[model samples]
Every structure is written in structure tokens, then in C-alpha cells.
Target: MPEKIIVAGVPVDTRHFIGGRRVASPDTFDDVSPIDGQVLGPIARGGPAEAEAAIAAAREAFPAWAATPRAERARILHAVADGVEKRIEELSAVETHDNGALLRSHRRGVMPRVAHNFRFFADWLLTLGHDDFETRGHTNHVSWDPAGPCVLITPWNAPLMLATWKVAPALAAGNTVVLKPAEWSPLTASLLADIATEAGLPAGVLNVVQGYGAEIGDALTSHPDVRRISFTGSVPTATRIAASAAANLTPLSLELGGKSPLLVFADADLDLAVDLAVEQYDNAGQVCLAATRILVEESVAEEFTRRFEEKASALVQGDPREEATDLGPTIHTRQLEKIDGFVQRALAAGARAVIGGHRRDGQYYAPTLLTDVAQDSEIVQEEVFGPVLTLQTFADEEEAVRLANDTRFGLAATLATGDRERADRVTARLIAGTVWVNCFFVRDLQAPFGGSRLSGVGREGGTWSFDFYCDLKNTVTAPNGWNNHG
Candidate 1:
């Protein structure tokens, strides 16, 4: 039996973080751990009132934070990064315990990336400047100004990292923010609020409201004081947010769902292709950018499927606290059933499973790979968001592109090929926001990140993120003796 490890010493209060203090709500809900379906603790369940409070706090803080010198903001962001780094281990543990994510993944991958997000945006803030143009008769200046009070809603898949993805850039661009984390994964986010306060972030600069989206999502999106909203979640929810934002005519950015593709060409490195297929099983396929559709050339399809099956089956799905576990349980029972249903439907449609076609335990679904699935089948077309990969073979590059681009989502895609020219050509034709030629999940913090089509609207990361959190302000100065009719 594996030794059970429980996270201790961290405050388990799941209250809202407003104005640098923890505030409790009249009502609350239990946070159940997916690991064994036990109640971890009760979390303050917030509603419109909580949302209003957070937005008001941010509204009050916007002017001072926006007016602070760029260098000063950069310094404070670095301190926030430092605080996260110092408490990295505990923070990762809290995330693992709350989200049922693998311990190693949070400790090494997500936590460090969260810290990097802060530092990257802090460095980018230093390079921000006003553009000046002196023409024959007049001078013009263009500058970036904070978007005032903003609402940042992040998903639960990688809570801290995704939160930082939105928060760091918004703050770096001088916007005071109200963050609404997914209720399923709120522990790390609540902790991050305390960490940021300790790092010298002023009161009301950053507030976290923890509750269900149905309760407070509209409140945040439709509030008149909110200048912008950045969201990452499902398409249906995004549509609702869009509608709410429209009521106030507020600016918005959304990174929504994806049913991404991973194409393997006949001329590609076979070993590398197999490796990449197995890698998509990471985070138990809960990632938005995960390659759920595997499109392989007919010639190498058999070999690739064999190797990929071996690797996928070998992945350990055990206790998240266990060091050797490669994958953890799904975020909740509903997710586990959803993935299981997809595999069952595919099987019913005559698809063959090479391995793993059943759920193991509480919130634990086996790493599944389906072959011979029809191109238009529900499993192949929709986002499974689980540890399931469906394979389909194509005869040529054109067919492969056709099969890959069939989905409404164009968030991310990956292709494996040794030829640089082919790689470049195929990637250009691929309808994805981000395409990887020979790699998987190799990200640069400075690159613009988001999807096209239904995947997302607008972008984040690098200067793109800064621009989203701010509005461009332009000024014109006329010459001393200028006339309107001149």
C-alpha cells in the first residue's frame, strides 16, 4: 500500500479575499477532494454581494496603482514572484490537495511557471513607453493607459498558473483586479492573495472572490465600474459572459475550449511522435491546449499506435501525493463520468480501444486510446477533456489538414515532421492559434498566446497581455499658429 500523505499547516479557510483581508460569507459550500470523495472543508460561497465588494475594492485602488511609476510596479511584481518562489513547495501541495493534480507536476511545472509569469510581465512593464511623432505642423503622442478596474476569471485545471497568467499581466499593465477562481480549485488562489499581500501589494489592488460562476459571474461581467474582463473557460460560459459584458459595453478577452489535433506525418521521427502522444496524457488531459485528436499517416499508423499504447498504458494513475504517480484522479466525479461517457459512446460506434476503456475508482478514469474511431464521431469531434486520445489515419497531407481543421475549435495543434519545409508548410495550413512543429507544450512567456475561431477571442502573454489589460491613449498638439481650415 502506498503511504498516505496529507497536506497540513496551511489555512483551509476558503473565504473571499477582499481589500487585503479574508472575508466570510453567510453561506458556504464543502470542498470535496476527488482523491477519495471526502469533504476537505467548507468554503465561503459568494454571490453578487461579494462580487460587488471585490469590484469596489479594485475600483478604489485603481488610480494609485495605475499612477505608480513603471519601475516601482516592476519592483513590486518581482517581490510577488519572490514570495511565490519562497512558498513554492507548500503552494504546490495546497494545489495538489485541492485540485487532485499530480504533486510533481505542480511543484516543478505549474508553480515555477506562475512565478515566471509575474517576472516576465514585470520585465515587459519596464519596456513600455509612449510613442512620439513630430510632424511638419503638429506633434502626436500614443501611450498605453490602465484599463481601470478589471475582472479576471481563471479556470481550475491549473489554478495558480492560469491565475498568474491573467493577474500578472493585468497588474503589470497597472490595472487593479478582482479575480474569480473556479470554485473547484480555490485553495491556491486564496493563498496567493495572502502571498501577494505579504509581497507588498497594496490593499484593494488584488482581490479574489471564491464561489460558483452562476452566482457572481454576471455581477462581475456586467458591473459598470469594470473596464475589462479576461476569462478562460468553456464556450457556453463564455457566451454568457459575453452577453453580460455587452450589457455594460465593457472590453473583454476570452480563452475558451479546444479540441486540438496532433498530426504525425509518414516522414516524421516515429519515436518522437509516439513520445508526444503519450505526453498529452499529462494533467489527465484536463489541459485546454491538450491534443485530443491524433491524426497519423496511414503508412506509419500501426507502429505509432502500438508504441503510443504501450506508453499510455504504462502511465500510473494513483494517489496524487505519491511521487511516482504520473497521473492523478480527474478533478471531480462529473468529469470522470464525462470522459467515460465519451469512450463508451465511441465504443458503441464500433471504435476499438487499444487500452483502458473503464473507470478505475473515485474520479479515476483509465488513460484511454481509441483506434478506428470514425472521423465524424462524437469522440473525435468534441473535447473529451480527459485522459483519452482517439486516433484516425489519413492518406495524405491534404487529408490530414482537412481532418484536423474539421473542428470548430482552433486553440492549438501539433505536427511531427523532420523536413523543415514540410513542417513550415503544414503548420501554416493548420487552423490553430498555436502550432508546434516537432515539440509539445514548449512555451515562451513573451509569445502571444490564445486561440482563433471558437478557441478564443484576443490574445494573452507578452505585450499582447499588457495591451489587453490597457487602453491605448493618443494625444495631439497643434502648432502655435495652426488653424482648423489650414
Candidate 2:
């Protein structure tokens, strides 16, 4: 077994994984569990030196790993998937302990998706095709060349799943990676490094550096040797990373903040609409793509609000380990305070909370719903990444579309309509990168996934992932040329 440390009575490896080994940091920081405000363990505190070491390791390993056969790479990724599947329960519990998300959510969907992320990209690599065409008596061959060392900065909301979402494609593309998980949730990332090593991934192919972004993020992002970066986090942080990478001319794929909208038409089913609305409270409304700004048709706004209030109020909030729990605590006390501040400001600005709008205890923020909010208010315009939903009424489809597109964010949107024609028409008019009709959060790995406008910088999924992680090169060969010398 890898080096282990006791965290909240469980053995965990909190050391940095560099150069295919568990390395200790000279300094350490307390990793507090958000569930109960207790110190779980001491996480390795990595700084510029650690970052440089990991980058050098990835740089040293890149060429050999890139030269490996695609078949062997696929097999190793499959083995990693199998290892993740075997530890689903352990990972689920550990994630809940680390980030205060519901364990059931992790076990049921999140962890399983982590495994699938690796498996899907692994299989995708084998089936990936290149273009070869003959033009003007010359053959043009297109190839996807692996980029060098990459940096993946993942969020605390869905740590391992989102990390592997980038990691799988980067590794499958035959590039070395150094992952920097959010400070609030770093245990699962350490676990993932171990899993990848056990699955026969080559030494230095994947490294984990643990610390706050302020301490080590710049060192990784601004490194001249780092070729690409994929970050999933807040807009402010993404902005800083972009600035750092700009100095090196390093390419970046950013999946940032969202204040997305959900439109409910009068012709839609009330129960289904209400069900979808309540689903936003999952993970305490920390989901970036969640339909938090709900726009309901005036005809059914009253009924929808009534049903939504009841469901949101009835959601059981307690320990994530319990199977009966529907919602868990926010990631930390600071985040909880931020959520409360947004609700308080909205209330002072004349909005009414029909359900909940306060912090419950510890790190738990009550699921909140606000009505009569102004279109230009901060609560409506800013991303309140907590268990808060804002509702607005629209006179018609025109007003609904206008209201949904009012914000600068264009990450995602959801629409509920019975008519196919109306769905297509409104979906076309929506400014979001992803628009769901009569459904929400149903994702296919093969589809293009990302944001537009201020929500993100580039896309990631299927070919789009490879497009960012690899360099596309074209080679032209002379076809039976008579004269070679000119």
C-alpha cells in the first residue's frame, strides 16, 4: 500500500505524488472537513519548488510516454477504470468526508462517472481517425500530435470526476499531466494518483501537487515547459490563470462560473417541471451547469412556485453518510457565509424568499428560493454558487428568451415545452453553449461541452478534448513527382 495517514479515523495518503512516488513536503496544512468543521488531517503544502519538481518530472517522461503504442495506452487506461470501479465505495465516502457532498450522490453518479471518464477517453483514442486526402497530385495527411506537459486545475465541487474528465483525455492523447486539485478537496486526488500508478501507468506520467492556488498555482501555470492547461473553477481564478499562461503563450481550456437559466412553458408538465426545478438543490446547488435562474410562464407561475416551494422545503438536510439525506453542507464556512450574504442582499433589495434563505448550522446553508428579483440586481447577474434559486415570470416566449439571455453568462440553459417546433425555435435563440429541451443535466460524453461568453474559454468533450490536448499537424507528400531538385 502507498504511504498512509489517519484522517478522521480513516487511513489516507495526503502526500504529493511526484515522479511516480509518494514524496513528503517540508511544510503541511490542516485539511478541515466541511461537514463538521473538524481537522481531518495534514495535507502536504507544496510551493514553487514542488511545482518545479513535478513539472520537470512530467517533462522528462513526456517523450517516452508519447511514443508508446496507442493500444498499450488504452489498456492501461482500462485498468485504471477497473481500479476506480473497485474503490467506488471508498472514494465516495472519502469525497463526502472531504467536501461535504452527499455520499449517495458520489456512489450513485459521480464516482461511477469518474471511472467512465477514463474508459470513454481510452476507447475514444483507439477509434479516433485522421484525415488523408489527395489534392493536386499530392497527399495531405492529418495527424494529432501529443502536446507536452499539461496542468489540470480542478474544482472542489466534483473533485475526482472533473479531474479525470480532463486527465483521461490528456493521458489518452499521450501527454504527461500534473493535476492541482482544489485545496478544500485534495484527498480524492491523491487517491486517484495511487490508482493510476497501480494500474500500470508509467512513472512520472501523472503527478499531484497539493497546496493553495496562491502558493503554487503561478509556478505551474507560468512554467515555460508546461504546454497546456485545463481549469474548472471561478471566473476570477480562471482570469488569473489565463494571465499567467499568457506570459508563456501556453494554451488554456477554461470551464468557469455559470448563472444559467431554466425556462418553463405553460404547455409543459407541471410535475416534471417541478421535479427538474428541485433537482438544482443537488450538491447544495454547487453545480455550475444547474438551472438556478428559473423563468416560468405567467399562466402557471403560481402553481409552479407552490410545488417548488413545497419540494425544496421538504428536502432532508443532514449527514451525507446517511442514505436518507437529500442535501449536505456547503464546502466550507466561508462559502456558507458567501451564500447567506447573497440571500441577505437580495432580501434587502425587495426580493421575497418563499422557502429558505438562511444558514442552518455548521456549514449547511438552507435551500433558498427568491421571487420578485430585479433583472439587473447582483443576485440575478452574479453566480451565487450555493443552494439558492431565483424565480421570474415572463409574459411570452419572447420575454422568456430575453430574460434568460439577460445575464452575461452563457454556460447552459434548460427549456420545458411540449411542442417540438417551439423547442427547436427557442433553443436556437438561446445564447447558451448548451440548451436542454424538456430535460436537464442529461449529458453524453461524445457531445461538445463548454461555455460561451464569460462562462468559459474553450470546449472539452470527445474530439474537442483532443483538439485542446494535442497539436494537429498536417503533412503533404509529393505524389510521383518527376523532378525532385529545383
Candidate 3:
């Protein structure tokens, strides 16, 4: 049975939102819940026109929002935080219904963190503190201003958290925005817009647009009025958006994918490394920086593989909505096929699946660990973006670094070592945007997060995001006795 959900106080098919109004799609597509392949609902299918309208609405609203006082805007943001808190249960239920995530996971983890992000940015806005930049000598520095409309394209895996990563900073910098939440799971983003509206955010400050990416995302990326575009997803898509934006000289912020490596040194904390390694791949190795590759010393490689495979084999795979399910079906059938192809490719190349090797049902793919994957194999070189991981063993510290930095991706890297010398040496060499010396995904809102090379350009989740999202114009005054005009 399809559950009835609301967005912006209006009933939407599958609860997707587009424009500032409530409406259903002319044609609907089944948004199947990943758990058990249960059909979630017939979500409306919006085309390019809907996407264009969303951009137009966002463009219209940018001027008023930019002129609004920062403090006032901050207060409205605080209300949105409160709304998210008040509607926590409702929001969690929608997420659980729409996604395969456990309700407990939603209630306990996702909601609170989202509220925290909203509050964190609100506090950050206040810290802007009426701008008291010091000017030395003849230079005069006043307050910097906002750019204009921004379009945020986020993915399904982390709908709200990633959306907040862009929205919070962009708004805090005083720019209005158009948000294109991933079509697969648009519920959270839709409801978030409603919550912002209820929280007294002036209309047009934020416009949530939902639809297929090729049409919607393309419209957003090439929208003439959109001064900034910040997106998080695959590299090929990021490359396309960058090219489109370059045509207009529009600034873009990209948070692309990664095939991050996790290094476990000889002198490292064995228990901690083992524990994190096993648990890291639990979310089906579907995280952007999930330490997909483990490059360990040859001595301990056998032990690590044994423990890792043992853990992977024992994990319970099923419905994400069920509290007992440790693992669930992937988001879609296409992803399952992608993962299956990687496994087959590995097997054909003489690689072995120590734990999981095949599919159970339509969307249910077992958590898999591939051993003896060649450096040139597709799985090792490309971002599988699924539950599959390829294992490798390294000889010395230098070999460890080489293996870790082998991939073209530079998103995040982790080091496991009890020895300070080994930890420092390996950490310094890992070519990732974020490196965890003794941890994984211990994200701080205050820390600037982004990637290097193909991973992305520009930063997010810090004061730096606000700085880059806005443009700075210089004003120079000439003194009466200044150099004579020639």
C-alpha cells in the first residue's frame, strides 16, 4: 500500500515537491522501498518544464532574500530548526517509509543531526557578527555581499544531511536557492522545504524542485540566472555540470565520489582498525568515503581478511525498515545489476568473493568482499558505489601509501596505527580531502570538507563555503595628491 504523505501542506504523489505549490505528477513511477522490493508508491514524473519553473521561481525570490537582514534571516533559520525538532517523528516516519533505513536510525541519528546542522549554521550566521574587518593604511574593507540564486543538486543516499551541507552555508551567506533533491528519494527534501516555510521563512527564499536529473539537473546546471551550482554525486555528471557552468563563467561547488583507501599500519591499534574495517562496510559500502580499500601489511593481511570476511558473511541482510536488519536491499535494481557486474568481472579475472558472491532476489545483493582484484580491474579503479569492496595487501609503509593513493579519487583516507611515527608518515601521504588518523566519518561542521582533483573543487560545511559561495567586490578611493594621471 502506498502511504499518504504531505509536502508544504499539500498532498503529493510519493510526497515529492516541485515549485512552491502542491501537485501530483501527470505520469507516476513506482518508488519501491528497497526492503523486500515492496512498492512504495507511484511518484509523479516531472519533466524539463517543471524544472525550468523551479529555477524561475528561485530566481524571482533571490532579490528579497538577499536584501533581508542577516540577523532576521538567521532567526527564521532557527525556526526551521525548531520545526524539524517538533516534526521529528513525522519526518523520521516519512524517511523510513520512503527509504529502507530503520526508524530507530532515523529517529536517533538522522533527525537530530539535521537539526544540529540547521542550528550550527544559524549560530554561524550570528558569528558573522556585523563584520569588523580591520583595514590597515589606505585600504578600506567593509562588509562583503551575497552573489545571487544558487541551485543545489543532492543525491538520494544522504538526502537531508547532504542537502543541509549546501543550503545552510549558502543561505547563511545570504543567497536564495533552488534545491533539486534526488528523484529516487525526494521526500525528505520536500518536507524540509515545508518545515522551513512553517518556520516563517519568507516565500521564495527556498524553492524545492523534484524530477528526473537529466531534465531537472541539466536545466539547473545551465540556468543563466543561477550564479552558483553545488552538487554531490558521480564524477561523470560533475564533469558535465562543470563544463556547462564554464560556458557562462558560473562558479560551481562539486562534492563528487571516491574510491577511498583505508591503511592499517603494523604498529597501529589492531582492535580499533579491525572493528572499524568490519563496521565501515556495513552500510553496504555505499558511503562516499567508506574506506572501500584496505591496504594492510603483508604479515597481518591474512588475519585481516579472515576477520573481515567472517564479519561480512555473518551480517544480516534484509529490510532497512526492520530494526533487526543489519543490511538491506540497495536503493534500486540498476544498482544491484551494477554490483553484480562488478562481482562477475572480478570472478572472470580470477578474483574470489570471500564472503558474498551473488544476488538473493530482485533488489537484495549480499554484502561482498572481493580478494585478489588486480590493480587494473574495473572494481579497483572505478567507484563501484555499491556494497562491493576489493581487498589488497601491501608490503611496507611506502607500499601502503602507494596503494592508498593509487586511485584517481581523493575524497577521504584513514590510517590505523598506534605508533606516532607510522601514523604521521602515512597520514601525510594519503591523497584524500579528509583523512581520519584514528577514525572514519568523524565529521565536524566547523571543519572545511571538499575534495581534490576529480573528487571536486571548492569546499562545503564551513565558513569557507560561505566565503566561496559569495562574490567580493573591491572599492578603491583615490586621495587628492595621488600619482598624476598619465
Candidate 4:
């Protein structure tokens, strides 16, 4: 039996799920909780051999799974969603313990979204439409065929939610998957495997391997059998994976890093702008789509900065389990150090720290705000991926658009303006995958999601997801009279 530990009163198993069974590795690594730096348990350490085994299982299972009826696949995926809903409380606690996100956010928002991901994709698959046309007495039809074994490498920052964002769609399209959860938070993925099994998903249909990216990521990505690769993480890592996948000419869908901007116009509602600014601190500022760079209209820059600084400083930072705590600790000491380093360097370079600029306690960095930084500075151009925000002022719409599109990363951006025409005109000019006006992070599962330029390649969500996970083949019938004459 695999080793089990109790977290938030729920027992969590820390082992790899491959071939529909819990497989133990020769060596194991400790899974320390970021909440208090306590060792949650020892997780199986998988290497190339384990990666090969998991891939083999997925390859063996792909044909039958692909041949399964679309209705049947949809039913199984719905069951998976149902299973997730039944254990929402347990999953929420485990994820909070594993990743140091606020318990309330996970319970109220993230976990529920995870279930919705499965349910939404399942229903969408059944009602999916295809293209068919008739011309010159011949008919042409387009059909989506499932690709073979797919490898999914997910990031630690929104562990299970992000994982299912890809998994649900891949499985719903009849592709088998080998998911590799980030090493820092592998507990919930283990639980997810068990949930899928209970929901009637066949063995080898969904296998998970837990370990560092260096250990098994290459083995899975470079495998000859892997037909599709979908990854969500850093740009450098994605670059390496792209290089490896190039060997086989394997198709890839990458959702990479971002230093997204949020523009606040002078005519915008001050209260709503302030609320949206503070929200960048959500998930400890580890969000890819977060508006970390704030460009305020010159007339309202001072008022907006003061309000943002005051509200950010007052955020309740404490144990994630506490309901009143608005902020949780960073994922670990190293991540905390990295976040602090970004702030310290900006200060040394003549920028002003208007509010927070230091670590408060164990793994808890203060919510930070900076101003008077040059537009071209490293702190403004690069992605900090922490609870840090930088303030800048712009003169007009053209300047706002310029500053927003100045960075190499273009995952997402937001605009806070009361002018409807301005919203339409400016959003059209912004270089982002998703643009929001008077709102932030409001996502519909049916809409397209992903980034552009250095942010990412290809889109996912709705039919865009099926486009990446399946192969579109067209069939044409012979003209009726010509066939008879021949």
C-alpha cells in the first residue's frame, strides 16, 4: 500500500497512479506543506522508467478509448464531475494544504470551477457541431478524430483547477492522457485519480506521474508515441519542451508566462478600480493573467495609487485555513525569496516602495506596491509572479495602449473605464488573448483562452480545445451522375 497522511482531516495518498493502480517508486520525496513548512508526506519519486511505463499504458489504452461512443465518453466525464462535486470539501482542504491558497477561495471558487470544467466539457462534447456542405452534387463533411496519447504538464500555482482545464477537454475528445502535476503540490492529483476511477473512467485512460520536471518531463515529452503536448508553466521550461518535441515533429499547445497590464482611466469608477487593483494580489500574485502592471490616467494616478496602497497594506495575511485571512503564504521559502528579491532590486534602482516591500513572517511576503519606476525597467517588463504591483501614469489613450503592449508577455490585460466607446476602441488595440473592461478574471468555459507572443502559443477552451486535442479530417462524396456513368 502507498503511504498516506492526514491533512485537514482527510487522508491523502502520495503515490503514482499508472495503469489504474497505485505504483510505488524505489525512492520517495517529502511533500512539505507551504502553509507552515510541515512535511505532509513522502510522495513517490518517478524517473524515466516510470514515465515510459505510464506512456506505454496510455498508448495501450488509446485505441479502445478513442473507439468508444461519444455519448459514452460524455457520460463518464459527467460522472467524474459528479465525483468531484461530492468531495468538494475534502478536495478544497487538501488543495489549500498543498499549495497555500486561501481555504475559503478554494472552497468557494477554485474547487467548484474544477467540477464545472469537467461538466462543461462533457456537455459541450455531446452538443458539438461539425461542418458539412454540398457543392456540384458532391457532399463534403468534416469530422474530429481523437489524437493518440497526449502528455499534459501542469504548473503548481492553481494545481487541480489548471490540470482539469486541459484534462477534461482532452478526455472528452477521446484522447488518453498522462498528467504530470507540479512536484510542489502533488497530493490533490493523487486524489483526483481515485475520483476518476470511482466515476467509472477505465484504467490507463488517465495516468498521473509525480516528480520534478527534470526527472520525467523530458521522457514523456520526447516520447515517440505522444501525439499532442499541452503545458502550462514558465517560458524557459516551455522552450526546452518545445525543443524536445521538435524531434518528433509532435504538435504542442503552450500556455506560458505573463506580465499583464491593467489600465485605469480617469473616468472609471474609483471604487471599482481600487477593488480590481487589489485583486491582482489574488493567489498571492502567482496568477498568469494577473494585471501586475497598473497604468493609471495622469489625472487620477495619485488618488488611485494612494487608495491601492492603503487597501493592499491592510490585507489580512495569516494561516490559509483561517476564514478571515485574505492572503496566504507564498508557496515556499525559495519562492518567497524570489518575490522579495524582485522588490529589493526595484528599490535599489531608485523606485519607491509606496506600501509593502518586505517579508512579514514564515513564507508570508507583505502585499507590495511600487511607484516611480521607469516604464522600461526590468521590474516592469519582466514577470515577478508574486504579490507585487507596480504603478505608472499615462497621458492619453495612445500612451495607455503603448505602455500596455510594450512588454513581450501578452497573456491578458484589463481596462477600467466608464466610456463604452473607449472600451471598444482600446480593447481592440490591446495585444492580449483575453481583454476585460470594467471586470477582471471573469471567464466562461465556452470562450477561447490562451495567450500570444511570449505569453503562449495556440488557444484552448470550447472548440478551440478540440482543435488542439483532435485531428480534423474531411470526407467528400463523389458526384451522383458521374459515378453512375463511370
- Give the poorly placed runs of model 3, Cα more than 4 Å off: 1-19, 23-25, 129-136, 474-486
Model 2, range 34-133, lDDT digits (tens) per residue?
8899988788999999999999999999999999999999999999999999999889888999998998889999999999999999999998877689
Those runs of model 4 whose alpha carbons end farther than 4 Å from true positions after fitting are 481-486
lDDT of each: 0.88, 0.92, 0.76, 0.92
Collision pairs in model 1: none
lDDT of 3 by residue, 1-486 (tens): 243545324443354344456555566666666665666556656666766776777777778888888788888888888998998787777766565555677788888888888888878877753333434544444455788989899987767878987887788778888888777777788778788878887667787866777766787788788888999998998888898788788998888888888888777767777777776665556678788887778888887877777666778777666677777667777888888888888799899888777898757777778888888778888887777777788888888888888888899888888888777777888788899987878899888888887888878775777677777755544344667776
Better of 1 and 3 by lDDT: 1
Per-model C-alpha RMSD: 3.7, 2.2, 3.8, 1.7
> How many clashes (backbone N, Cα, C below 3 Å) per candidate?
0, 0, 2, 0
Q: List TM-score per model, in order.
A: 0.96, 0.98, 0.92, 0.98
Residues 1-486 of candidate 1 have per-residue lDDT tens digits of 111123446665577889888788888877777788887777888899999999999999999999999999999999999999999889988888888888888888889988999999999999876668888868898788998998999998999999999999899999999999998888888878888898899999999998889898888999999999999999999999999999789988999999999999999999999999999988888999999899999999999988887777778888998999988999988888888888998899899889898999678888888888877789988888999998999999899999999988999999998889988888989998899988999999878889999898998878788778889887888778645655
Model 1 residue 291 CA deviation (Å) reads 0.9
Regions of model 1 farther than 4 Å from truth: 1-7, 479-486
**Steric clash pairs (candidate 4):** none
